[model samples]
Target chain A: MGRAILLDKVNIPGIRAFEVYREHGGYKPAGKALLGMTPAQVQQEVIKSGLRGRGGAGFPTGLKWSFLDRKSDKPRYLVCNADESEPGTFKDRYLMEKLPHLLIEGLILSSYALGVKTCYIYIRGEFKYLVGILETAIHEAKKNNYLGEKILGTDFSLEIYVHPGAGAYICGEETALLESLEGKRGNPRIKPPFPAYKGLYDCPTVVNNVETLATVTSIISMGGDAYSKLGIGKSTGTKLMSACGNINKPGVYEIEMGLPVEDFIYSEEYCGGIKNDRMLKAVIPGGSSVPILPADLILNTAKGQPRLLTYESLAEGEFISGSMLGSGGFIVFDENACIVRNTWNLTRFYRHESCGQCSPCREGTGWMEKILYRIEHGQGRMSDIDLLVRIAKNIEGNTICPLGDAAAWPVASAIRHFRKEFEEHIK
Target chain B: MLKVTIDNILIEVEEGTTILQAARMIGGKVVPPAMCYYTSLKGSGGKCRSCLVKVAKGSAKDPRPIPKLVASCSTPVQDGMVVENTISAEVQEARKGVVEFLLINHPLDCPVCDQAGECDLQDLSYGFGMEETNTREPRREYPVVDIGPLIKLHMNRCIHCYRCVLAAEQLTKKRAHGMLYRGDTIEISTFIRTAIDSDFSGNMIDVCPVGALTDRSFRFKSRVWFLNPMDAHRECSHCSGKVAAWMFGNEIYRITGRKDTFGELEEFICNECRFEKKDISDWVIEGPRKIKRQSVISGNHYEQMKKGSIIHPIEGTTEPQE
Candidate 1:
């Protein structure tokens, strides 16, 4: 597998400043794209490359760019979602701390591709230290002519601002990030007027996750086809996965898409063969939002094929059995980790972060959490197990946004995939 | 102009409608229940199972899609889709099952609940609850909290409908509320503290599906049924926006986002709107009918306006100007 592009040299020497970065071909892509191509041409190249968002939505990056409300007279804004609040999803944090410039470079180029002049890096408020890291890098870039007014005599100018969240998890949702950036509450605005249309003070805006935007500089440098060649099928290109829990290397690891789940977890090089050499009980392939797969199911699919870790293969069935590659928050559990209790914890997070928006999610998430809390505390009844599943099913696909679905995924899938664990916990 | 029969009653409604919305078009009750449907928001927030109704496999004339009960809030009504919202014992049982599940963990704390007389869960339990719980397990406990300086919480009464959270996120133009925990252990909290001090924080207490998210201002003030609901729209003196203010005993206690308008987003009424009703420092005094002007802009302004009046102008002052 190819080493992560931005992460590869993150710890390497000569990767900090533009002098060091430029000495090792750092601004080559931005320079080449700026000097050699039009913004439309750059977007077309990415679209042609078939690169999808690494933010777990797996939405085509080029399409997302193309969807911008182009005719709008309002100023276009590029918002980089630095709010990495999803549990088990820590890859964005690593990128911000280690490879800030990589992200900054990506933001500039992606901004250019969208023809944006002012961009906002909506950092999660809890990343108090990261805000400074990003600020320092922006200052370094401004001093070196990377982010400020103009660069290398190009006809474009951009101003990047790092806006920190007030620590709400829903702020990660693109629209919610826009609301937070505008100094409004961090709740998501309604769609159809998706952020691409009217966002951040009612302007045409594009909100891309940190990893999703960082991939653009590579796509521009290598051309779309070369970047697309790194991965397989509709899910093209490499993804930076934060493979934590029960793994020998519980750190951020970038792997080519379509790598088998067993190989990613059990390989001596990757997760380093599940901790203590225990059996793999389940793997939350995407993040906490994706449904867990049993060791057998993780190794093979419903058709008896090995479960390939691509967007399609992992979420082929629907339900958590089939789920959105939601934010790449992969939490691993060994045979001993109770799927029920872990699900209860995740539900507790959703119930907590529910933003209380929509009835089913607010009431439904809280209801599911309470019942599961009871079951986990050892006062579980047979009916309580059924009640947990019932409440989750009720809240699924029925809210103002996907937060309700996010809340329901673990509960519905935990029961679907690990009904036995729930039954066992019922005393 | 699509036509469909609901429970053998033929009705005509616009095409591209949900059965619940279609049922509502005829001006009576639809047997299926909905929690997320704020009919003012076009009635489609299908997060609750109470709105489940069985639909037929094919034409409206034939009914044979067994177990095809779908949430009416989210499900769109098709031309030939047959709906059996109340025909079968099965539909009623499913509704009862859902209501019972909703109540199992619900705190029977309605006696002290501010929303006791008008809560949807209270009404639903009356209509469909079948659970007779003997389990002595204590109800979920949450310390009464001041979530926002304006919004008070008896989280124990929260059904977690998320209406308040959604309103805060989407309607109130702020992400003031969210779930704090996951699964049965999950709860609604302000992440760090319970206080939602946003100017829009008062909206949560109204959007709360249950008494869990209650208003500090209206808490234990009066039963909802005791207060006569007046259908009057008052202009927001602070802004051009009009708020639907509810008056209890000739005094306006609360105001909310009025959805009973044409082509307007459910604009959240801020604390200024909800609390401004009772903060009336002055009122116009009328003697049958008379014109008078009294100004307190400056100490002598009241006298200046009254200098030309036939009757001496009367003005009460809370503060004196220089």
Candidate 2:
């Protein structure tokens, strides 16, 4: 309802087709970026736009691009992170399935901005059907001269490849995604030598989320200043949220940043309130990895200010009484939902998805899941609560990757906010 | 050179030295227990979270303390960095929690396990684990795998440290075994029932921190504490022939890659020295008296050996000759 940049033309018939998509102003930004703007100018415009990453980390997109080891003689690469495996998040898949050109156009502009010769859209393996749609879109774009060699009569040449992951949640992680792209097991590498310094077969690589790349088209299309004026401070521009769980409508919605959480959940235009008109119990505003908040906290902050969808507003109080706007995976739970069971289910997912590279995540996730299962099934002891908290604390930061913290946050937050629900599950 | 403070003890080490290595270099109680880090092998640490330490002040290159407790094994020492390991109560508790998670599904079959005497997990649990666990749920169990005639794998005992997998990949270059399944159900398995069958396959048993992979040749042969390990070597075409002969009475029960005082293998010996060479006649045995004081398994054995508890009647044998 509020300036839909990403899904504006999604409902159009045959928008996935090249002719229809181009007619709807698909490749204009690619041409403008290629023929008119220098790569440095394009990158500077993005920087001035204040566009943060749509990825869960919310890193500033331009700063990440600037961190590339440009001085190195190694060829630069840009990877589009389309491996959207986060639970309660399906927005990236919708963009790829419906309007693949939007993403392709964005990829071209970004590749040009970074001066990358080769780019890859690393999609989730489970999205096999979507891959066909993307492949066709790429073929059509190449046929139409939007992609491939000497685009728009410019000296710049670019090639895009669609690489599919073999079903791994950890592949959503940039380092692990790079490892998978290199035909290795999806295990995250150690930091300090970040992806910017050394990535993608040990060459400097810029890995952006699918939504982050798609949003670049909007930045170039509307001019960076105009796009920068669309959202709140720091969290600039529109965002695509995958709204799900206990709501009347559960699907992807693109809303300009600074939208009120209350309206997004209860208003008829968005989620249309909880299912069966039941009272809201809690909400996981971000993906399953983020901290879950009770209804009061999700609607308003600890200071009782109305919570907005922006990254700054959602994470106002840190993890104690607040949660993150991670990947915009807005999950609403009605009063009937059990926090213990939900937490257990998420823990199980993390335990299953752990790449088994780090011991804290590999062993701790399994331990937490078992403990959570015991508590969820009326076989828990009171001490198990403290034990669970202790385990989650240990795993929070002591891992080779953020997967450890991802698996830990939900459990810790559930216990922090919903200790009573956990107690009720015990015998 | 980079100067780092571990437990308030100042030391200077070359750049790129990990905090774990620096602490080991200082050589005191400050040596943080590293469950998965094999110093002899490259790219072996970062899996186990046991070696976490707090850096109050970061190095000169990056002055910001990396907001979280970092794995000391993978984190390089920076100039003028301040790291706290056992000195910090928080780090101790976190390590204790890691040890508990490792032991939760470990089956605690230490009494019957062959790697009980020198198991890193056992020593780490004793040093850092809680008195008891709170979970009443059943511990996970796995079917024992006999990958070949040389090794017996108790998969349930594996902590997923990946040391054996690295040994297979780095030392053997065969990569015969890999983790299969996922999450808590993850287990180390081979593609088929193919024998691990590599020149350095026996190193997997030696590198295992738990009793997951035991040498079939030495299975139930004798407790490692009862065997007197003597330094010995043979000239071989395969590799550096340095090895240790574990002798029970006058007969050698098994042979393994000789470890330094720090318990790192002197060299990764081949399967021939590990499995085929069991006789005392395989190499000239060094005198037990001449063996370094650190070569004994524990301080108790060190004192007894110094007091001449078991006198060697022959030059290479511990038992008296008739």
Candidate 3:
């Protein structure tokens, strides 16, 4: 509802056009960079700002740009990871569905900065409708001379294509997404030959997440320094928190990164408090894959300090204890919700999504899901709880991608945080 | 290399190695029951729950706890580490539960399956299954599904092990199969029935630990124990990812995934290799036709007709003899 850099004029009557964006001092950064600054200088400015990826990982955006294998004579490529298929994450969907131009403008600037001639937005298959919306936006951008071949009379040329995924969740993983882009299966490739080093038909590439690329537009516009002042140390800027489940307002909201968790949960200014004034049973601060935190532990850090929403504060006392800030998929559990059922839901997702590439994840997730389902359905024994823990432990670090970890973490955390609820559900 | 011990047995393995991988390096070094494990899966997929072993703690009075099993499938090796694989009542109980759970819908129709000779469930059941059915009622039957044109389904026999789905996803770089439900109600289904078809379809039959997913081409042909396996990397009918086919009575009856230079079979097979296997297996060579010559059936009427049918009147076309 508020104005973040990306959504500044999204709801306005006349602001959805290039002319309107242009009037509001948009595309000036690209023009400035093209007309005045060099690509290297633009990268240096981004690096100086210390902006991190808005996608799940929170990787340093400037550092990601810096990792481009510049030594190659081959063309450099940029891929936008629009496959935002994580269960609780929907920020990118809102941004793309509402204000497609912001992403396109950011993409153009990013393309110019990285010397990328071709950019591809690899969106998840579920976003099939959005693909046409984005295509129309791309067509509109091209008509206005911002997308194809030499933007605003600059010698640099670029073309953007929208490629749809076939409903595989693993495509959200960067390496897997790259492989899919090359018309291969959506399995994650091994690291070291990471997409940054070698990717997209085996060329030098930079694959930035969708929200990560959208942030680039504002960085160039308001200047990275101004953007940096919005949040706390390192985790600067406004993060799009996708709050759902139990909250009165269950939707995507732009909030400063350092907002207090207590305030976010109870304040009228934010989610308008938990539903029906029910006692908050728990909160999955980041996304579903992160550990679930009990209400009290969520209110206080491990050292018994106030829990703020900065990545550092939220991440304090992690590892089988605290919750994760992954992908910003916040799920809230009120008293009415069943912890075992909710956990079963998340485990079911991981079990379903597991590519089965590795033995542990492929088999473990399925096994765990079945066990959790049993527990929730009143078919579990006393020992099933311990078995759930053991199964999750086996899957934690033993897979091709974080999807395994993503699947295992929630089960482990849910068990760790709500063992009583699980016991209660057990018949 | 980091030196480690399983029970009292000492072994050395590389750094960044899981206890499972270390055990794999030294034959019988430390037997961690790994159902779904390999070093390549980026160390995850801990499905089988069989590789449980005990580790050393600091006390002598009670050096070993009551439990003596840890899933060696994913635990990495460390210097001076110690582990024990003795069967504890708890480990056995856990193993039993997991086995019984996996067997809920598994059609133990081993006598009719092509994977019977080399099945993990059959092999692991002795050590894991208690010979007592957890459920008192009749075993469940999962409805058989037609996943694709090439691969056949025996969902009843499937233990719900997802090895095949992963193999197809990894090799094809496309997610062809996915587990659709959650918990005991969870079933493996494609997002839609339209087409789970892919080149890597045969690999599902390969990684399935039981008869849950049997090949339609070789469905009623022979039991797996009768087939002799030859490890020749036969070029896939379409892409690389050399598929290993089982030969029974001089006929290649079944195709399973083998470890390859690429990712796992399910995930790594090219679409062409995955889908075109059935056509390749069913190939027939046409004999040379002689327009002027005929078969040596020099008899009247019926014999002449048989000879005439054998030879084509047209030199290059397959036409009836005049």
Q: Individual DockQ of the candidates? A: 0.11, 0.66, 0.06
TM-score of chain B of each: 0.75, 0.91, 0.70
- Candidate 2 lDDT, tens digit per residue, B155-179? 9898888888888988875679887
lDDT of 3 by residue, A7-112 (tens): 7766766565666767877677778877787888777767866778877778899988988988888888999999998888899999888878888888988888
Docking quality band of candidate 2, CAPRI definitions:
medium
lDDT of 1 at A268: 75
Per residue, candidate 3 scores C-alpha lDDT tens digits across B1-322 of: 7777766667877777766666666654245555555343342344555565555632234444423344566555667777655534454555555565556446566666666655667767765665654332345456667777666776656555456666666656577777665334456777775456654456566556666666666767876544433333434445544544444433555555553221233333444433344333342212211111221111212122322232232352233435
Candidate 1 structure quality by residue, lDDT tens digits, B169-272: 66545566677654344577776774576666666665666777666777677665443233334455544344544434345555554432111225556677
Give the better candidate number (1 or 2) by lDDT.
2
Worst 10 residues of 1 chain A by lDDT: A184-193
Quote the lDDT for B183 in model 1: 37
List, residue by residue over A1-427, the lDDT tens digit for candidate 2.
4788878899999999999988998888888878889999999889988989988999999999999999999999999999999999998998899989999999999999998989999999999998899999999989988888988778888899999999899999999999999998888998868999899989999999999999899899988899899889988988988999999999888888999999999888888889998999999998998999999999999999999999999999998899999999999999999899999999999998998877788888988888888887778999899989988998888888899999999999999999988888895
Which regions of candidate 1 are displaced past 4 Å? Answer: A320-324, B1-26, B30-322
lDDT of each model, Cα atoms only?
A: 0.70, 0.87, 0.69
lDDT of 1: 0.70
